[model samples]
Target: MNETDAKVPVDGSPLELALTAWREALGEAHVVVEPDALEAAQTATFATTQRIPAILRPADTAQVQACLRIAQAHGVPVYPVSGGRNWGYGSRVPAGDGSVLLDLGRMDRIVEHDEQLAYLTVEPGVTFRQAHAWLREKNSSTFITTIGGSPDASLVGNALERGDGRGPHADIFQHVCALEVVLPTGEVVETGHARFPGALAAPVFRWGLGPVLDGLFSQSSLGVVTRMTFWLARKQPYLREFFCTVNDDAYLWDAVDRLQALALDGTLKGSFFFWNDLKALSVTQQYPYASVGRTPLPDPFRDQFREGFGRWAISGALSAPDAEIGALLERRLATALEGAFRPVTFAPPPPDGESHFQGVPSEANLAMAYWRKRTPPPQAPDLDRDRCGFIWCSVALPFTGAQARRAVEIADRVPRLFGLEPNLALLAHSPRCLYLVTALAYDRDARGEDARAHACYRALARELAQAGYFLTRAGLQAQEASPSVRDASSEVVRRLKAVLDPRGILAPGRSES
Candidate 1:
């Protein structure tokens, strides 16, 4: 290769050589080689740490392809991050050390929004808040499903990760129609019908004529998703938020059974969540470490919380075209589990209430991360700045009440044994299964807190896995928490990786298990 084609380094390290080539491919202004920035890029939201050489900010698909080409030519690994707000899952940190972070934050663009079709195509950098605002500005009657994540979190990134939220299309990945992926070898590819020229139904239909390749890109290291079209939920006339409580474990299990049936039958068309008191308290207020002394808040305080909010709470939206249908659905929910749960009530959207179903993103859920912090959290909480350590172990469980009860019992007990509060919730995204999401919160500055948090998470994960409950999402620390992969399946994955990314230049340690 000539000098003009690519930089040839003689004295500098491999990373330095790669940096030179990247700066040329993407403008120097787009390349981040500063030590402080590189260190920040290597830091996840929790205790795990890795050293990334540099960060390359790609603006568009062409730039992403160029960056990948440069990395392939220089024999340097590249890790792609859409928004760097992965939080409990390893934020912007690369899977392996010495890799350069491929940050796609600059590609924020809403390519298309068809109100009649109820779909929106966006770049990887488009955030939930941005898309919500865009729809309102365009006077569109459709909205995307938003998660309880940071407002800055990428819409495409979260969907590709199969993140869940509260809406008609709460299962984010299922709503994605097509993807524009940049392969490891610097080739650009489009999933679904987008591969064909002038594909009119690319954004309308999810599956193409032949094999469905969209699932391969999500939750895997096969390719980098540059663009995605999401099927948006329609904004109906009659909309109301509902809330109910379960004061005891037995009642909670029964309620889960009833809710499962409703979800499966489409009575509860919107997604809902059942979160424990600990999760409820963390979101409302910080842990009273000074008054309670970390002794599991006094029984009196617990009683007060139970009287006001119950031991566990379930919240979701009931949206319909008219009041009569909405009332029918509410009546169905009321009679399904009569007297099993607290008084179920539906109210108008409060002035300050969250509009998550309408796709307005908020960071209120992030308060759980700062539960152990002494200082007050800011408007936009920063986990690293507040020294709040967090790790999320989200496992999939059957929709049966028996499975939920056992999972809750194990989740509640394991963290207490490790001197940590179990902030747990059951996200019922699908009718057949729910994600039992548990968060391990700790103070990073405290002595041995990091190590303790990791140990607690590992034990919790192991116990859950042993009980036949395996994680749906695995971070760097809990990658092994997944069920044992069969030899045949493992070999198939290895062989596919060898063909797609032979050098493993794309996230070497990012396990899809």
Candidate 2:
């Protein structure tokens, strides 16, 4: 090749030569190796001492493939991240230390939009807020499903991790179609029908001929996704929000049983939430340090907080073709939920277009990290920069009342054993199974606090698994706490990883189980 190839070695290569080639492939300015830059990128919300060697900003598919080729030739492992707002998970931290970070944030591009087919093709750097604004600019009626995390979170990264979102497309992965992935060996290929030349259904069809390979790339260390097509949900004429307070465990248990039919049938659309009082309060206000005057807030005070705000708050949305059908769905909800719990109330979506069902992105819910923070929350929350200690342990359970109640009891009882509050919730995104997501929040600056918080996390994961509920999505810390999570995958993933990434260079140790 030309001088831009940066001279590959005939045998084993040193990391310096690989770095030189990376700077040649991507510009020198995009290849960041500054001490402060690597330090910042390696920092996670949770406690971690792993150091990142460098960060590479690839602007397009060609540059990404080139970077991968250099890393492959030199035996330098690299991890690709989009927008790097993983937050409560691991943020931008890779599975192992000393790996070069491929920051895909510079590849922000809306490649294609087919309004007729109802799909939007985007580069890896495309975020929730960017897509929302793009839809508004085009005056398009359809919208992509959005997550409750940072608006800067990537669409492709979240879908690859099998994240949950709002609206009829609650399961984000279910709404995605074609994928453009750059393999570890420096080859790029398309998934589904996109692999075919001049295939008209590339963006619309999910499965191509032969064996299904779409799921292999998701949550794996197999390849770096450069582009993805997200199927959009059309606008509904009628939209209404349903919310209620559940004070009694029995009442909440029964409600979980009743709500499944609504979701399974057609009464409720989109992902709904059933968060505890701590989750509700954290979103609106910081931890009441002065009033509580303690860590973990004693049982008496905790009970009072729950009593005032109700033990749990149930919130979801209902959508239909028109107001008449919307009203009928409302009646069905009231009949099942209104008797024991407080009256299930309905309201029209806010005029600002920021409603959960509207698929608009917002940073409002990230305040939960500051629940234990001593300082006041900023307009934009940066957990790592502010040392906001947090870890998410989410597990799946059957959509039955007994299962929900038992999981809740275990989650509620275990955290207190570690002197940490059980900031827990049940994200009911599907009818058959719901995730019991628990957040472990603490002050990382305190002495021995990181160890305490991590020990608490391991306990939560172990006990929850013992109760027959395993983690749905795990972070870097989660994988370490429970190695079983990495091994939870089938033998196919392990065998495929050997064939696709023999040197273990691409996102090493990610989604192993």
RMSD of each: 4.0, 4.3
lDDT of model 1 at position 475? 73
Superposed on all Cα atoms, model 2 deviates from the true structure by an RMSD in Å of 4.3
- Prediction 1 TM-score vs. true: 0.95
Candidate 2 TM-score, true structure as reference: 0.95
* Total clashing pairs in model 2: 5
Which runs of model 2 end up more than 4 angstroms from their true locations? 1-13, 352-354, 483-491
Question: Where does candidate 1 clash, by residue pair?
Answer: none
lDDT for predicted candidate 1 compared with the true structure: 0.83
Q: Write the per-residue lDDT of candidate 2 for residues 164-230, one digit (tens) a residue.
A: 8878898899888889999999898788999999999999989987776778788878899999999
lDDT by residue (tens digit), candidate 1, 1-513? 122322223467666777887888888998986666766666665665567667799889999999888777768899999988888888888777667889999999999988899999999999988998888888787888889878889999998888888788878898897799999988988888999999999999878889998888888888999999999988877778888888878888888889999999888887899999889988998878777886445667767777878889888887788889988988998886567447888878544333777677778899989888777889868775566788988889999889999998999899988888888999887889888999988777778888888888889999998898887777787764556865687677778888888678898888876
Models 1 onward score TM values of 0.95, 0.95
